[model samples]
Target: MTQLPLLEQAILVLAALTLLASFSMLAQSRLTSAIHSFAWQGVMVAAATALVAAVGHAHHLYLSALLTFSLKGLLIPWMLHRLVRRLNMEREVENIAHPALVVLAGALLVILAYWIALPIERLELASTRNIIAISLAIVLLGLWLMIARRQVVTQVLGFMSMENGLFLAAVASTRGMPLVVELGIAFDVLVAAVLFGVFFFHIHESIESLDTGKLTRLTEEEPA
Candidate 1:
């Protein structure tokens, strides 16, 4: 048995922390806490990208890390916090229908991710190949977060988190995306955040709530 290099070990630790942050977002009831968890997840992902850059000597990944830390880690979360403040939802607490069941489902998804990544792991394409499983698990957890949470803001958080997982997958599998592509993605994400803010204000003004369930009821009540 051979010991992994220190940098690789640190990357693995960051990967694990990113996965835990995903679970934290899933189980969080308070919207603010969930947002904080998502922010930390971004920070971990940026750190992992930086470590990968160092290990592979991919100078571009360092830029990607800085971009990730700025956009995902700082800008997006700040936008969300501002939106929450404006909406007066700072203290809003969402009730997960079945907390334990949702967490168990998330655990199953992690197992599924590992099973799915087994074939890819065998390829040994990169030193960071094993991180693929964790990346996939984060993606699955993000999807689960969207499905299990009813609040529109929570769904947006889940969506952003899913993007984080995809970004991590790229880092783990391909060592990072082209700089132009990452820039395009960052711009698109910023646009989406602004759009979501506008949408939230519109929805709140029209219906006085951000609950998707209420939106369904509203649609049902409207005359055809």
Candidate 2:
């Protein structure tokens, strides 16, 4: 740690915090708190990307950092908050069959990610190599969150978190993609949030709840 430059150390701290935020989200029950954690993760990611730019001398990464901060950190979070308010689902608690087991699984995922990224880390010379495993762990955790939860909003949060992990991986490994590609991804996320909002309204109207498990009842056969 002492051998690395100060900027790299700072980025590592932010990256670690980002990973912690992912775990926090995985453990949180309230919808609003999960959204807050997701926003914090976005901020950490933006800060890390900006620091990466400083360390790597990639000025273009600055643009991506700004976009990520504005889109992921600010706009998307605000959108989710509004959706929660509109649906009156802000206080809804996620249903996890086994919280302790879920947390344990997430930890195991981190260990697995480290093992899988070991070869790639060996081949890479960037300071970000150390964090690649963490990024992959976050991605897997998000996927696991989606599968464990029954609520649509929670599933959406998982989806966004997975994308966050992908962005973090790109920034860490390559100092971010081209400005055009990042811009497209940012726009796509915004659009997806909008579409999710629409779906929420339709789902509520049809079933009076956002529980995806309720959808299964619609397919059951009726007596003749």
Candidate 3:
């Protein structure tokens, strides 16, 4: 830590924060709290991107960071908060089978991610190589959360977290992508969120519940 430059060290710290936020989201039971954790993770991603931009002298990354902060950190979260309020799901708790087992599985995934990234980490000539592994772990953990939790909103949170991990991995490994591509991705995420919000309404109206497990149990005799 002492030998590393200030910017590199800051980037590492922010990456760690992002990983911690991923874990927090996975562990959280309430929809509202998990959304908040996702927002904080976005903030960490933006900060890390900005720090990398400073280190690599990539001006476009600054814009990317701003976009990430606005879209993921603020806009999406605000939108989800409104959705929660409208759906009356603010206090809804996710039902996870064997919470401790889930956490242990997540830890094992981190080890697997580290092993998978070993070859790339060795060849990468950047200080952010280790972050790539962390990002992959985050991705897997988010997926695990989606599979283990039995709540619609929590699944959405997991999806968003997985996207975050992908973004982090790209930035760490490639020092950010083209601005046009980033803009497209940002727009796509916003559009997807809107569509998901609309689907939430229809799902709630038809089934009077947001639990996705119920979808599989629907019968022709029962009214949707």
TM-score of each: 0.96, 0.94, 0.94
Q: Candidate 1: lDDT of 71? A: 92
- Taking the tens digit of each residue's C-alpha lDDT, what string does model 3 give over 1-224? 34889889899999989988988887888889999999999999999999899999999999999999999999999999999999998888877777778788888999999999999888956878899999999899889888888787888888888989999998987999999999999999899889889989998998788988888874736555
Q: Write the per-residue lDDT of candidate 2 for residues 1-224, one digit (tens) a residue.
A: 24888888898899899989989988998889999999999999999999999888999999999999998899999999998898888778867778999889989999998999999898866867888888998899899889888888888988998999899999998778898998999899999999999999999998888988888885545425
List of clashing residue pairs for candidate 3: none
Candidate 1: tens digits of C-alpha lDDT, residues 1-224: 87889999999999999999999998999989999999999999999999999999999999999999999999999999999998999999997898999999999999999999999999989878999999999988988988888898999998998889999999978988899999999888889999999999998998888888677674646565
Model 3 residue 221 CA deviation (Å) reads 9.6
Best model number under lDDT: 1
Instruction: List, in order, the clash count of every candidate structure.
Output: 0, 0, 0
Each candidate's lDDT (Cα)?
A: 0.92, 0.89, 0.89
For model 1, the stretches where C-alpha displacement exceeds 4 angstroms are 219-224
Candidate 3 is scored at a TM of 0.94
